[model samples]
Target: MMFVIFISFTLSSITIINGVHFRGGMITWEPVSSVTNASPNITLLIHQRYAWSRSHIPCTQTNIFNRDLIGDYSFNPIVCLSSSTQCNSADYNSQRISSDVYCTDINLILGISSSSRSQSLSLRNNTKLVLAFKGNDSWLSLTYGSPAGEGWSLPVFIDLTLRPGIGINHSPTSTMPLRINIPIGILTSIEIPMSDNNVNDVIKCRWAKSAGTINGLSVDECAGACHSYTLPSTVQLRTFTKNRCQLNVTLPYVGYYIVALQIEDFSSNSSTIALSSVPLQFVLYGFDSYNTRTTCMTPPRITNMSPFPTSNGGNISVTVNGQYYGVIVAQTGCVNDTETYIANFITKSPSAMKTSSFPYAQNNTSQYSMELQWTPTIDQLGSTLTFCAIAIDVNDYSSDPFCVNFIVGPEITTTTDTTSTVTVTTTVTTSTLMIMTTSTTSTVVATTTATTSISTTETTTITTSQVVTAITSALSSDDGRILALGLGLGLPLILLISLLA
Candidate 1:
């Protein structure tokens, strides 16, 4: 009995130390400035994003908005772990960048939490380096793991080499949710949202590796959870495209599978070395009850509401120091209402952007909404920032990624021009007779005038014009006699004389 008790105590201690909290994470870097003249020396911003068990790393909405540090053991700084010359020295090996990851979001009910941190470092140009965050173990009991549990290792390859024409290189980014769920026995399509600043560069995706080096970095890309997906013999991938980062497959078994992939960018299709390599790790869950007898439940769809004019992938323009508001609405098509409902929202946004709490109530059935508010600062001017989101249901199924690109500052604008024209024609006539002449003489005069007006708002114009004429005539004695006879014959002569008087 004594020996058994000792063994039990030892097992409990081991479990506590391992903790099994890691979920998924990635690391990426970008140049601080677009200029490449600083060839030998350039500053880069390194960003890290990770998800963990909320039970292990607790966070609050307040902490997320305030960007407060997540108080946990994982807050330790990430260091260099590559065996290359850049990391061989004592100083380089010990080079610690604070992993001050702030709580980005928390879903206690789902037992998940996310955090992100970014730091800037000035390093030599045309150099290759690898940075990592290591942990004792990954999430508890992944579908494809040993009884002892697989360790958690996330390493990112940083290349500071400049492209031939594209001054500096920017790594590709993803907005895929950390977790996703699909119905069992049904084939589903998944497309990861990815983008790059260097539009000319070609991006590719591949499963993360456990052995060998990538881009000449001497380290395993993914530690233990490498090629961690275990598909049944009958199941085969229907379509897989590296350039688009898309896949179509069916998961027959009901279990959790890790999707560890590397997103790399190249100058062209034939380029051998990648400009930079970024890791995107997440989990895919298979469940049995996503479909019912009357109808087949599907993942929620993000509506193209106000501010978001286009459907899935679109772009919106904003200005610095101007407040921008956006609404994201999602709807599920499940006829059986009781089994599923929108639970939360997962987002990948720029720093300082704030998001409302999840599962906002709406009048429409099966509809959920969340609000995004942001005010771009002067520093972010002229930069195109990407924001991505996914609406998740209670069953862990998520909507297709809805990402919008925000073009910041005054680079893009809308201008309206209006023009109005007016013209007026006025004619004035005056007649005069001289008593000295025997014959009657008459003279007439006419005058003309013109005017123009112009008004502008940004750019506008208006115009105006006017004109006048004259005539003269002479009459003999016979004509005068005829006129007198006609006057005598006319009965209206008395009325005409009264008007003259």
Candidate 2:
């Protein structure tokens, strides 16, 4: 006996029809399309089972339906479009089902129970197909399998691609303040933007006093306080997580300052300091002062020291003269009070020497003098000494060091000696009228010495000798006295003696 059976499935606007036939304890099915406009490329899978189970068995049990049922009657219920030839290979032969054959491998089914058998059958949007069951069973006792299979069938899986997203929420170039005024000791903040999807990303910034140019503004035009007078100093900017950055700065002087800010992400480790990129150049105004001068704080200066080149002698006294002996300012406790100024003599060469603090008097409103003593040790003799004197105000504000050069020399010692010496000589000649001559000679020597000691002691001895020749010569007391007087009074003689001695 033969009977006709109808199976209908509706998904969205697509519907599938199958005709089931039973003959001689065997089942067969044919698919039909209800809609004519369905695309042949579109695939469909169907899974069906009884809504209620008599035994209350879970719909997810994998073992309830066996692949091998009865003799050559294969239980593999998967199906797919005839175009997918692999669908025809599924049978009791037990070759692990290929996603190519099973439509379920591609995730095409909906609403399946555990006991249901799986079949992969691809149908055009509104196509029909005939399927057959291997064994004879009441339609009420029959359960359907997932059109594709239990899980994501095989090869193609829904893939979601993710892309990196990072952007600056606030444009540093457009939104950043180009100019700002910060008072002395006052803290100021500037905001940086971090607009990105990554919540875990971090942002960082570093600042330099000289930012060549950012956007169209020259960084040189934005000079203030420290940046105005010296090489650009770099400061780091910090932020934790909020994607917002704040730069806190304290202005030191009343002048224009230009700073270049560099931004980077912690994760990317990239910075915007490249020439192609533009960073904000901030023009910050500092505190207002009565005497508006573009100068950094000056340390004490030692202008002059008396003597100009001091000697590094034992216990030598030195005098330092200079100005800015702690100029009174708003920072100091006592305004214009010179007494609060402290002058210290520092020895730079000999780093081990302690700083010498001395009192300084304002010789005039613009200059000052301070007296200090330096004693040189034996080792320091002949060694050049370098010294600087710095004045510090009560507020700990210090002036530039006034440096002095010193020459070390040995102490002077004097010794005196007086000496007297006399010499006598005689020669005689007898003349006979151009015929005969006779000659005689005699000599005498005397020495005297006297010594005077001062810081150094010395002993001196003197000796004299002389030779005389004439027509007639003899020793004379008068000559001796004359010689003595001449020897003592002669300027050339003393000079000669001094040179010879």
Provide the RMSD of all predictions against the true structure, rounded to 1 decimal: 16.7, 41.9
As a TM-score, model 2 comes out at 0.22
TM-score for each model: 0.69, 0.22
The per-residue C-alpha lDDT of model 2 at residue 355 equals 22
For residue 67, what is the lDDT in candidate 2? 18
In Å, residue 427's CA in model 2 sits off its true spot by: 29
- In the range 276-395, model 2's lDDT, one tens digit per residue, is 111233334354432323222333444444544332221233222111112111122233544444333212222112222234455453344554434444444444344434344332
Model 2 C-alpha RMSD to native: 41.9
Give the alpha carbon lDDT tens digit for every residue of 1-501 in model 1: 000000000000011245666677777778777545555566677777777777666666676666666523534556676665666532344446655566766665567767765666666666577776666655545654442336656677776666666766788877677777777778777877677878777788876677647666566666656664334443322213345777566776787766667788888888768777778877777877654332435667777646647666678888887888888888875734754677888776655677886678578767878888877767567667667787877666677777888889763445554343212111221111122322122222222121221222121142211110111112233234334433443435446557989
- Lowest-lDDT window of 10 residues in candidate 1? 3-12
Q: State how far residue 261 of model 2 sits from its true place (Å).
A: 23
